[model samples]
Target: MNMSDILANKVVVVTGASSGIGRAIAIRAAEHGARAVIVSDVTEAPREGGEPTAAVIEALGVTARFVKADVSKRTDNDALVAAAEDLGGVDVFVANAGITLRTDGADVPEEDYRRLMSVNLDGPLFGAQAAARSMKAKGKAGSIVLMASMGGLVGAGITVAYSTSKGGVVLMAKSLADALGPDGIRVNAVAPGTIDTELLRTAAGIAEASEGFRKRTPLRRLGQPSEIGDAVAYLGSDLSSYVTGHALTVDGGLLAVI
Candidate 1:
């Protein structure tokens, strides 16, 4: 089947799409023919060139809307769902918003822990819930893809809170899949190894040993957002009708090697 026709006339919502992996997924979804793409972030206002990803989607012939909503905030999550409903209906919801921070037990503030949990862990949970509600209400039988990391799958150094938060997301996705499956809503998670996004540049060890990730990763380089986008597209499309409650790793074989 032609990939471009996979998502024709479907509506997709992507969070954290101001840049990075979220942006890549949004653009690719539109390219595959999603009727309307909601480019969500934490900023208000929209523009023709409001976002790099949305710009490309519009250029490729799809209606893209920008909605500013902080994933951590319940009201924001609601608004995101409302935005999609306003556009018509949502067939895919990409829970791609997240934040990262590092701190030792001694120096870590309670607020820091709270903030990370709110975004990394809690955000996806609430987003999935909202999407489920929308899908159930509309009887849309949709797809929801949660973004996770190697941190979620394995222990990384020093960032205990960040690692734990993503781990929660992994389970959250599975739980949603199990519960939503009866309603025909497929839920999945994408755990990418290391990518060249702005988030990776600021990550603790990645920037310090840029070459280390390359050498350690079997591919001998960082993963790309476009690669993750392809995986997301598959999961969101009919191609993955039988796939649910799975953590699809896009780590370039990093997890395969010792």
Candidate 2:
């Protein structure tokens, strides 16, 4: 069977689908033939693939819906699972919601640190819990992919709490993989390096020379949101049935510290 159709008839939910990696994953997941595509995020504005994402999925002749909710809230996470169940239950979940700290060491305010932790750390934890519960109760196999960062695996110059939160997500996926494996649920993570997403452009300190910095990588280029989308599709699809508890780096060899 074609890999594009690996997710055929499967229902998937993607958090932070308003833009960046989450939006790309949603679109690619629909392209992969997921029967139902549910997108969730805190914002209501026109994201790159907001209505367009739903439209594309519906064009593929599948079901698609967008929900506005703050992923940091436990109730909101439960609501996402509820929406999936309302649409017929979930087979895959992409916890792509995250935020970056705009300030460096001393400039990073304590309140900002707390806000970032709420969304980047607590959000994914609650998401994994909700998705795992839904999948476990279904008595069938499922997949959960969380968004980590190259910083999570190592460390960045000024990531501070952002790195810490992603580090938490990376370990969370591993722990979940170990805990939910016997139940047929596979958990994994995607750690992106420098990508040409709007988020990267607006990220705390790495915006100005992102393109130049991307070129300095061994690959002589930066990655793209679409690349991460493809990776998410793999983890979310049956194609990766045997892959779990691993953080697949999608950077252009930026993590290759030789």
Poorest lDDT segment (10 consecutive residues) of candidate 2 = 44-53
Best by TM-score: 2
Give the per-residue lDDT digits (tens) of candidate 2, residues 1-258: 224787888899999986877877887887777889998888734344345566656776778898887989999999988898976688999899988876845457899889999999899889989998999888869999999988888866688788888999999999989999999999999999888887777776778868766767898887888899889888988889999999999998877854
What are the C-alpha RMSDs, in order, of all predicted structures? 2.8, 2.0
Model 2 stretches with alpha carbons more than 4 Å out: 1-3, 47-52
Highest-lDDT candidate: 2
Per-residue lDDT tens digits for candidate 1, residues 1-258, read: 225868877899999987888888888898777888999987532222354666777888789988888999888998888888867778999999887775633456889989989998888988888888999998888999999988789886666777788888889889989999999999999999888877677666557766776798888889888889888888999989999999999988988998
Give the 10-residue window scoring lowest on summed lDDT in candidate 1: 43-52
Give Cα distance to truth, residue 162, candidate 2, Å. Answer: 0.9
Write out the backbone clash pairs for model 2. 102-204
